[model samples]
Target: MGMEYEKIHACSNDCLLYQNECEDLDECSVCHESWWKKVRLYGPMYLMWMYLFERYVKILKAYFKNRNRPEGCVMESYIAKEAVEFCSEYLSNAEAIGLQNKVDSDGATVIDFRKIGYKNDPFILATQVKQVFYTTDPNDLELSLVVLMKSRDIRDGEGDADDCNCIPSVSRGLTPVDEVDVFDDDDSNLVRLDVEWTYGTRSGGVNRDGIDYYNNLINELLSNGLEPFVTLFHWDLPQALQDTYGGFLSPKIVDDFKDYAELCYREFGDRVKHWIPINEPHIFTTRGYEYGSFAPGRCSPWLSPDCNGGDSATEPYLVGHNQLLVHAAAVQVYKTKYQNTQKGQIGIALNVPWVVPLSQSIADQEASNRALVFTYDWFMEPLKSGSYPAEMTTYVGERLPKFSEEQSSMLKGSFDFIGLNYYSASYAANGTCKRINPRASTDSCVVHLSERNGTTIGPKAASDWLYIYPKGIEDLLLYTRDKFNNPVVYITENGVDELNNGQLSLNDNIRVNYYADHLSFVQRAIRKGANVRGYFAWSLLDNFEWADGYTVRFGIVYVDYKDGLRRYLKDSAKWFKQFLL
Candidate 1:
């Protein structure tokens, strides 16, 4: 048929493609094979293989009317087919020979080409398709058909199905694919639940709906043999509180946060033996108050004109100070009123990138230590020693908030454990003091760099800020042991992300390797007596990641956002299952 094509030679064992430099090679480099074999190339099959074109050729061959003039007959038939397809658009009851009518009586069309006789029937309606399944087990007999009919009913109901909770029913069908139990498969006994969503105004009363939902969720988790670790605040301050007193910027937030924490303790503390009063307070303080990139956005006008009017130099310090006070207050209430009766352990989740020196110079080494003092030790020192780091006190000066003697004692040893989120590391070098309009970020007098001398600390992840430095986990744990009096620690949030490029494959081996490497380091840290107690992956499901939104996926379980929000376990999740086993 005069079709253009190119013939490429490849190894019989599929070691490598014979192209470019290897075009003239007679045998495979690795296997030394002489004959052609199945080609293993990257990307979509349509672009790299002949199978699709071969199928099209078969279709074209069927258009031939005469053997003597096969090509001419195909050309004539193809033109007539195209003309009929164009004219069919104007005819109400007519359709092209190969095209089925999309519209049916109920405005829905279902096509079934599996039946032998109906394969070529262009106008097969919804009634013609039988709900069929082949299963040896009696329970699996009607599973797929029932789900299909239920989905159709949901679609037909439109807005009516919005209120229908189908998870319990639909999840039954998923058991055959992956019979995962929280305690059995993942070996996850401790589960973290964010309680910030339940915070409401004192005048308007507690959020009953949120409380009820959590009560059910908590009960269900416990029934599944899982313990709940409740977090009171995860940078989700109530809008009412933020509007009333500028949120964490004002000291007024301390009592309000304390009240909210107490409420949670009263309601759920009995069942929730593990409590985390705040998750990543430093991130909340800097991102929300100084950078103005997060909720209740506020920063120095000079830093960002779009800020909601804030003092970067003072507000970040104030916010951080108040958050510390808030955390202390919550811990005090829990330890005083709830701890004795509930028998619970409380902590705060703090995240910090492990800081390394840019070079071996003393200045860079000291800067790296100073950066840690400013970041990790900023909160840790206060909790352990009842005061901020000396580096922070000297550099930030009057801008840094001081705790009164009474508050200082309350701040000391506030937690039974520390929940640490370590993802990436950065190289720090000594930086010049910003004499003019210095903000909290620059107050450390340390320049943070991902790379030095054109070499990165580690491989980059989908999130530009996240670099894979698995050793950082071990180093950070050891540092925590040495600097913070070896407090019991839980590695709370640690995972990497990949771009959501709509790839269909669930072979997430990179994520598997990431988890394996990081977990191995965690084990090493534990072996070295770092007092690390537990480890939890950052996420279980692909979710709405703040700032980045849905552009990146950090979950081991892949969520098909395009396909009814269905979930499939990636290779990493399977690896985790086996690892835990």
Candidate 2:
């Protein structure tokens, strides 16, 4: 009963549903659902508070003086409507203007914004605790980004709480993997805040200036004894590039990417070991390029997959086919030219959400299998084994794209390593790819669906996408190792999000728990003989998330939007230093 009211008080979950359930004390409502999570980026509390404060005494006096007045008796409904209006405006303001801003003595300012109420708290910012990154700042340069947060992550004096978040039980030897350096479009060590091109006003980094900025940054990183794991693109495609050749689908991109890869390899190959030719190609292909989620935004569910954008109903796989070819050609060049001398290995990074079946029945299982094969296996087999999964052929048909014999040979079994990008988990039902909505559980995400008889459960945290089932990651590792013959695996991305009184909190106990469980999963996979070698947290700091903008934050070190006051260590981050290092 109390939990139900908590929803109303916070304007969380489904308030109407909660109220309906309350009205049916002994019975049930036609519309039955679950309780809500935190307020989305938009909620009604801001207005409610304003209305109550504006004229409480006046309302009381009016009620006594005008008890018989028709309009006086209708104050309650008017107040309710006003509150709703106010909340919409207030939330819109927060997302746009963001939380209060503060400037440090150094004069760097932090821009922080809260996403709407926490519907799927974890989903918007991902919940899988991969490598917990310790980041401070990044200049618009590649090399500087490599070392952006490293020096600052060090604790001062006995590791006592001196502005940095710390863990008493953590040990120096326990950090899972060595910290990574940062990179950017600037050649400097510190990121450019005032400039729109590199920071908030991110213009696609297309010009020679941006490339030089990256080259210099990478050079600095190598000088610092840091091996580079370069992500060629990080949602920073120069608007110029997009305009030049239809972007992703433009045939010209193949040659352009080839040139970029060659340049990256020639200058930094001697030191940089890992390379992700494209970062979350799916994201770039679909969300950023096709739909208007990131930049060059569009809203198509499908279409223009590779070079030309199109609708989701049409298999965007054809366009993706072209992208895969480019990836293969790049790998071939690395092998035939750079590998023997540079002695460096490379792999394409893939983002895969753990998809579970709603039930144990054949239909649900089939759906899960298809989702995996369609989404992940599509990328894996083509790169690792050098062939796309056969199942995809039937589903995608002609929309999938053509592969010549020579191209297949080059593309098939083409990887030196496999990078896994894990985040939230979703469950699918027994239906067609797009038709699984009714059975799929996006709202009741923490509650895994069931087909057999009993309840299907997962771990629950404050996040909506984070069901805290560390076991899922373990399962993911085992699946990857088994499917790919135990190729070297890297956990490339993961994190969580939470809020505090009127502001967000970085205490992040939920995050700590989230990490322990997932890393333990990684450890279990290692013990089980999975060749997992390294991990990198999703982010070093909370930057503007695409489409969603600055709402979702995944940084281990909180970037105080008020001022450029960067403090070190959240609870999970401190714990990670000891337990994982």
Candidate 3:
């Protein structure tokens, strides 16, 4: 169905519903629903896409020719048709009542939803992995090896291991490493450590002390057959670079990023097999530049008053262009300098929501395709075809940045694999583009909605923007396979969130269902021959969420903010343990 039919406004009490009638009402006529609820930012009209017709209703009460006989109006005809259809459906389903009566018994019947239910394991047996490494001595480049022993570690301090003892023996500061034999206990548990190279700590590039720290960390991880998937830059750019020339806005960032990547390759490439040069470039650029909700916040004055000064139309594309260039340069450095010698693979992580066409109409189908072009193909096209999508170039025109032949060549096949972060889906419809005001977000000329026909696309999450749609993961994977030549794809990030409610128990049943359903879709995609390799949940712990702060928790392991940051394995974590077994 077309998204036009989905434009519905209902009173808080569900007493009165409005469709094409009284769309501009400040309050519901019946219950007077809260104005804030009706004017929510996530409403269909204010979404990322541009639409020709506003989704809001334009009431023309004067058009009623027969005010007394309102049933004679054209709008009333559709309501009458719906009533007749409901009656017919009731009559047709009457035969099913016999089956229901037969199925219903006098004895109490148990409805077992345990397979999909969220129930924590009575015993907390799941392992929660944490990073631990030796302290770095600035003077000495060599790392002293040590192993800390902790059976059932429970602490927020320096040396805390999981269920098994694969802990780092050195203290936080410049404490000396206490050598402990860690090879004593080797069991069936798989051990792996995730290490991140320091991008820059507010100052310039990583100093000698930070370099030494990472060197020690990698050495420790490798010593115990624990391989590391090192992420070079996790949206943590040095403040110096940002201050120097607007960081990703200028072309100057490419070389500096290359230098950083080369340094990472030279230092830890031997142990770090998988290198993600940049994590979620789309989020970094769009959120940071266009929306100004993130660090280095910059956006048009109309978009946000908090922004210092930025053109939402131009800066986001510029930032994205620079990110691709920087990523290409980093990959080139790795390929030329370290790939053969270090035996490592490098890729960039990109986040794109699955876009579903709001209607079967050609306009909406085209709009859906354009939405993907602006989001997923915005990066993937450059990486694969050495150019941006034609749809983007056509719609955005000169506003969309371009890559030179050399830059395009470098970007093409720069990655060893594709890292995709999929979470939710939205309905895309043809949007009306206004020449007066254009933006990177609205450049695609499409409108997005999380619901259709007054029914949500999926259940809502704690995050207002996030709607749970597990089928989106499968559809996205298949789309990537068909469109992007079926490259090796790793689900780099996928998870849902919930509000941090202190009144509720630590057991997170919703998260368990989220994982179960999403994983099932991933499995289906794999069965359909999507070259999917790995899947990493968005987070292991409920750490800081970027724009939302600590308001929402996406962690499989819930972190108690009030309780000394103590971690409790949520139902999802226990479910994962049992699932993996």
Candidate 4:
């Protein structure tokens, strides 16, 4: 395996077969010395016809299988046979394998990819992969297993494959629990810990135990050598406070969040550094306010309900004003009090969806632009430049509150990075700015992102409201980079949905493809100078999918709602772990 130097790119199973194209692309030195030493591996004419059939037949089968499964789950089914064996050989360990079986006559073997490695393991995850990939017959069953093994990582929920070097994801929205420990140097090893500044424990009450729970979770994660991420606020917004003051719409939240964040940082800052102050504020606010879907359930527009200036109700802009104040105040508090002690990155997360027009007409473009402004620019303006977007005034008029110069400066330049969450896209066409009729209030049709023909676009998925759109992710990222002068970005959330055990394998392969395509595009954006850093696949476990309310499963680890037993580790999770390693 020395002296024949040619560029090779084979890793898990992408073998870069080299050839001297100027003379003999056919005469591979390695192939000539194989089992059929006297015969050439291929004749010149056979190479073209062979790729069409021999090389891609399994790939085609996997495609049809993938189409019918969770989404990409179908496509991932067919992998290059060499790739399969490559994986089998790399992770060849058997400390915890629970199931191994031959799957039907075609000879596909389903091995538990997660259980391939123990504390001590080989590099060939499948029992055959060596230091570098070398040629084997395309029909090799072991290679096929490698393909399936990697695909399983991302196909559904977390599995035994959870032990990869990829960016790690931890539990979201934690609740406090009683802890027991053994008195030893490894005391931290006995606990499973995580931090949540504002999580609802039982009856949606603030678990006043964010600090203790997170401390243990962080210590345990550190003991396990896992890099922990602490999201300061997810929509859990201390139910007690929401009942006390009106939540984000009330400026009082600024003080409340400061105290809460202070406690979390004080407890877990050493082990937990990356902080997300709020997860998808746009989704939380719009879903709750305009749609009356989430917590606080306030449907009235942000300004006074009286456009005539009579009946006093909070208007949209006024509420936005409070959101800005709270966000800025919290950031200011973090910077003033904790920045010196804990030198970790902190930022806000945004839920970005693609907005496209049906046509090239100026009106149509304007419609699409307007939808984006209402949905994203509402928060983007304050985050990027510390002021509301100029367009808000046209949409909300007096309802869009004007922040004083002092407030604008306070909100400006406050983030270290941006966490982007994406799912789908919408078609926009001209529409009334704000609807006042009750009929309009009853329907969940988001006027902000709509099509004129009344036919909403984008491929349909588990959520009736979201149309699966891969390009939306690309557009949103490029757009964000252009708007914010290249802030660091991570795809904090991006997932597809599916039902388990109905007709399909609860395996979410489509979600896997969705991630690959979107991430591939994200990689391209990075090549083009977008400071995108990492990606966190939405949920680590299939738990309650808010609003949709547990109907849709997005975790890499499938949760058995009964007795809370989690059994399935998704294909996507497995694949992602490989990419990380």
TM-score for all predictions? 0.68, 0.59, 0.67, 0.61
Instruction: Enumerate clash totals for all models, in the order shown.
Output: 0, 69, 8, 62
- Model 4 scores a TM of 0.61
| 513: Cα error in model 3, Å | 1.1
lDDT of each: 0.62, 0.46, 0.59, 0.48
Candidate 2 local lDDT, 1-581, one digit each (tens): 21223323222322222222244354322122221221220111110011112222343233232233311100010111222222223212322112222332444221111221123221111112112212111211212111221212222223332222311111221111112323121111111011111211112222233334345544555443334566555544433345556555565656655655676677557766677665566665555433433344443433333322344433245446767877887788888899999988878778777878876888777777777776678778877666778877665555566677888898877778777877667677765343432111111113334222444345443334555455677788888988878888777675555532225465776666666556656655766877765655544444433232233556554655443233344555444433321
Top-TM-score structure, candidate number: 1
Question: With candidate 4 superimposed using the best TM-score fit, by how many Å does residue 249's alpha carbon deviate from the native?
Answer: 3.0
Where in model 1 is the C-alpha error above 4 Å?
Answer: 1-188, 197-204
* lDDT tens readout by residue for model 4, 328-365: 77677778888778887777778877888877888878
- Ranking, TM-score, top scorer first: 1, 3, 4, 2
Model 1 agreement with the true structure over 286-374: per-residue lDDT tens digits: 98788877656678899988777898999888988998999999999999999999999999999989999998999999999999888
Question: Can you list the residue pairs that collide in candidate 3?
Answer: 6-453, 49-446, 50-431, 50-432, 50-446, 51-431, 51-432, 52-432
Query: How high is the lDDT of residue 65 in model 3?
Result: 36
The regions of model 3 sitting more than 4 angstroms off are 1-206, 223-225
Residue 454, candidate 3: C-alpha displacement in angstroms: 0.6
